[model samples]
Target: MLYVKIHELRKRKFKVAQIAKELKVSRPTVYKYLDMTFDEAKAYTEQPLGKKRKLDPYKDWILAWLEEYPHLSSAQIHDWLLERYPDLVVGGSTVRTYVKDIREVYQIEKKVMIRQYEAVPEQPMGKQLQVDWGETKQKTTDNKEIKLYFIAFVLAHSRQKYMEWQARPFTTRDAIRCHEHAFQFYGGRTEEIVYDQDHLIAVSENAGQLLLTTEFQHYVNEREFNVHLCRKADPESKGMIENVVKYIKGNFADSRVFSDIEDWNSRALQWLQRTGNHQVHQTTKKRPAEVFLLEKQHLQPVSSLLSYESTHNQSITRNVSKDNTIRYKSNRYSVPLGTYQTMSENLVWIEVKDEDQKTLVIRREAKGEVIAEHLVSSEKGKLIQNRHHTRDRSKGVEELKQRLVSCFEDQGQAAAYLDEISQRYPRYRRDQFAIIYKIIQQYPAFIDTVLTKCMAEKLYHANDFRDIAHHLHTLRDEPIEEGQPFYTSSPKHSHIKASTRSLLAYTSILGGRA
Candidate 1:
């Protein structure tokens, strides 16, 4: 219409400036329309003015790189191009837009979509809770980027949700802890929980059957709750929790400042109580907290579920070392010596009852036999031993001490030495006594001498006793000349000859009288 008006005005001898002012268009637009025929102006309006892009020359390279590394971000691709072709200069946003277009054109496989399923109707109140994990990168107050992982649980009927965040990924133990807290927050637990095949809970799926992780399976059995695993890659199956994850990211996490994980979690709890659960849910149009009151009665009583103590019961398999010890939480706990007679053949299942106290109950995995129990040590690189596990070895040491004492008429000193050694090196008493026993066996005559030297030097170690024994043996074995007096006393030798002559004369006198 504007073009026709312009043509009619131009034929009427109207100035291009007047047409531009009347139409509120640029003078150049008016003049261009004035120059074109009516049909030509319409055709020109239909065609788009294609502008060339700076990245046009590198389209082929970008597309090829995307085809090879589809996961690379635009910034990463930009850096790669700059390195590959130093003369290339392109903005990151341009590469991002171009990469997106190339992906659409080539039909690149960005993500493999699983089979879709329709939404399932809501179950009875407290009948099911959908659980999932979501991760987001957050910047700390110090301007450091940290990844936060959240475990989200949403009631299927009430749409009530519970979430917890941590700076680290959730292990099986952490998952269980989060579940317990969620249940406690709701004042109860649902009869079943729906999961999206989380590796932390579900290990694998075969023929539509879910194989839960051992820890999760035990937890389910203990809590008396059923589990429903969603089909692989099927988020819609447990979409309630997925939405909760998104809602948290958009509403609570955006532009939030938290000092640390604990602070964030505390704030998150307050957010759930004050805003998240109290707000009218989009789908249900009812406050989740309000609906949860009705659902809470349907949920299993908090007291009926397993206690927090039972939920955290952890059974970890550990290889027993040759010294009858197993490492746990950076400390060593002793097991029975027979527990690992063959290398790599024995694995003990350490059931930790109290982590704070470092108390553990150990069992032989192969035979299901309870071998030993120990109070775990808090200090790292320290060994906590149970003397009962080495009772036989202790008995052998007792026998050696008795034999050494019997070798002396004055056994008081020897008994005192053994007692002192047992007290000084309580854990290694057997080893220390064994060294003493070796010294006694090698030089029975020098046993007292070695003990005296050990007491003088305060050497309670086994090697010290061995060294003293070697020195004593060397001294006792020194050669002596036949003419030299063994006692270095001439008066004692002359008295010894006179007594021998008197004894012979007395025997002759008695024979002659008979």
Candidate 2:
């Protein structure tokens, strides 16, 4: 307005310098304003009026109708408005413009992102891998409800995924088992595997220093694979595996039914290779399997180092009956019968692997003598005693040595105890010595005690310590004799009833008189 005022004044022959001074605008600007026609001046003042959607009657109806029928199109609104106002004139374009303005107020349309582009070089294939756990519901043949866990591993660049499902809980064992199977499935292991800090593999500092389970460490060390854990709450760290899980859920496992976990997993693997791995990645424009093969080419071969194999070690305990037989798990196995010598203590050692809980056996612990063998029946009526058979008494001691060796096999220094003992006692064939060893087995504390006693007595022979132990047992259980009474039994045959001196001593000593 100030510029226009000055311009109008200038056109009426007012001096430009004077108009500039009055309007507080520059002289050039006043001249520029003066150059404009009446229509231009009107256009400048009318700009706001042209652009603004006025709160007039027709605009009011449009706003009200929009609140009620938000989905109505601009044309629909235009037609509705035309019906109401015969005098009010507007074009489709005007109505469209108003619809856009209303949308901005309501914030309904999808946002447009203007990305500043930067080129990211493709990552080296197999340089990184991703892992995650997925779950699907299943039912057994008998309609038993169950949920199965699948560990998903995917190559980041290729998106080639391997899935392994287990019927059991996602324990540390299951995790390692899955990894081992996945590596075997790929014919090799990747250089680096990214994990989501899954509780089975890694825990937080707050929880304690993140410690991988021994089984998991064994797998990683054996395979020579580097494990990288994603920072907590950072799902994008293993985004490839996460995406694979989503893809599987949507394309394959979603709403799918299976007989059991194994069945579900078999179908999942098939689907992954056929449907998921073969699909073209939206961004990479390459099939996952193609990229995966390229990744495999770049990967270091599965280390020539020992491959991690699944190990299922279980411990079994058995009771030693009066006959020195250790009924472990369910089978009756015997140590040296000398185990029964010690009445107060009883324990036997056995190592078991991959045996059914109900039918596990305890053969003689010694090598040569299958001293006693017992077959365990799954039935309830089976008598453990009926199954026992003694192979040879002469080999019983050797069996005990074998048993002891087997007991300490998993331990370090203890494993060498038998080997060293065997070397020292060459005369005591492992079988003969096993008898004395059975005593040590029955009384493990006696290993040191008998050893010390034997050394102290210079008793190199097993029979010598056996004799000494028997003597100690006898003395320990000896009965007291009541024959000898000692109390000055020169019992006064002479002064039978009335010696004052004797009476006083007796009274003082025994609180009584003769």
Candidate 3:
């Protein structure tokens, strides 16, 4: 307006000094405006009104940083600039101001549009419930940092909410367990549950169609409840539960000391009962607990849905390896040796039950025969073998014992002795049976004597029987006369044999040297 008035006064042939006084402006300003065309004056007025700052030199660099890391804060960028340029010293506030201007100039900063969602007509009590999960990191009383994940459920009408926290991320089984707990907390279930596109439940989405994970699909089928998966990146569809997740992190988890997962969960439950549910909800303007009382009657009875027992019985199929083992949850479990011996597929059914201590029950799907049960391990890459599954060594011992009994059947006492020794020394029964079989093969006549001596000496070892048989053979080799006394020493004989005559003949032949 000043420039237009100055130009018009000049067009009326007013002097620069007079125009300056009339417009209450300086002569230099009036003359400066009067020198410009109308278009140039308008363009000059439309220029950015702020003055240049020291950071004007690094505007491109700041924009580049923002483009690379949009989540970087202004303070972080200021620190980065100090590190990049050793001589550059700038205040954090100055950097922040410059970054704000740069972001506006380039339109690089994320602009969060406040979306207005049309108020959905109120759902009937127990008709719909929204579920979601949120995560945050916190420090415990001991100053140990831990990440916490929480699952929250909110009834659409009454705004009744249920929430539980865990120290680790959730799996499909955990999600299902949370759902079961939420339903039990409400004393019933809703007709349909709304959820975001979480990988634990929603596997994939195509043209607004969702395919649920296998375990979640089975859980929903058993429970007989409809599942509503919100569109991708859209939280407003399940905004109630989303808000509950935030409320839990802000209210229940903030500055909370986590001694342990179980204790923390217990306290979280108490918090929900005392503070979360009892407080007047912001939207409904009624206490959620009070509203839940009226909503409870309309919900599907807990007993009417699938039993909790079946909902938690998650079953999967695993192929048995050549080592008679099956892999489950990164661990290997053994079955009987012949369980998968001849099968073409070598597949077995594994049913996992979520308990205080989780357990895996493996069964032969073909015959519905349970082969093994084991406590599930949290550690990865472990091999858990059942000792009873490898009984082949014991069966071999039994076969050896039967052979030993059949080999010595002719002599009752010998056979009984063999059986006794075999049964007594089961660990070495195969060796004992082999020794007995060898004796029967080599010393068929001395079997009874060897057995008798062995039993009398209380010698049950295989080498003991072999020594006894060898001694008997030595006695048989040197026989003694019955009537004559055995010679105790060398006997002296007066009458010599023909060796004396041979010595005299040799002397005569040596030229009568006698």
Model 1 C-alpha lDDT per residue in residues 1-514, reported as the tens digit of each score: 6677778888888888987666555577677777878677667544311146677677778778878877777788789889989987777788877666555434444554357667577689878988899888888899877778999988999988899998766767778888888888888888888888777898788887778877688888878888888888777767788889999999999878657888999999999999889999988899999999899899887663555464454565677888889887678888876777763456677776765675688887623778888886667788888877774756677887798788865699878878888898898887787777777777788777666666766777778778767865786767534344322444645555443456667778888531
- lDDT of every model, 2 decimals: 0.77, 0.61, 0.77
**Candidates sorted by lDDT, best first:** 3, 1, 2
What are the TM-scores, per candidate, against the unseen true structure?
Answer: 0.43, 0.39, 0.45
Off by over 4 Å in 2: 1-122, 139-144, 205-211, 303-514
Best by lDDT: 3
- For model 3, the superposed segments whose C-alpha errors exceed 4 Å read 1-116, 304-514
For model 1, the stretches where C-alpha displacement exceeds 4 angstroms are: 1-119, 304-514
- lDDT tens digits by residue: candidate 2, 1-514: 5545775686688897887666555576566557767677567444412355542346557667777766778898888877886666787897887666554333334244454645445667767778899876755566665676678888777777788876544766566666667777776777888888776786443433456644477677777787787778867656667888887777786667668666677788788778888878887899988777667877666643344333342322344677766644334555554555565435343444345453333433312233343445455433465322434544666566666545432333333444554666766657545566566555453344444455544456656656655554555555423332211246557756773565577678987755
lDDT of 3 by residue, 28-108 (tens): 666667787888766654441135568877766778898887767789889888888979988889888777655543445
Candidate 2 has an lDDT of 0.61
Kindly indicate the candidate among 2 and 3 with the higher lDDT. 3
Q: Provide the RMSD of all predictions against the true structure, rounded to 1 decimal.
A: 17.9, 28.1, 20.2
**Which numbered prediction scores highest in TM-score against the true structure?**
3
lDDT computed for candidate 1: 0.77
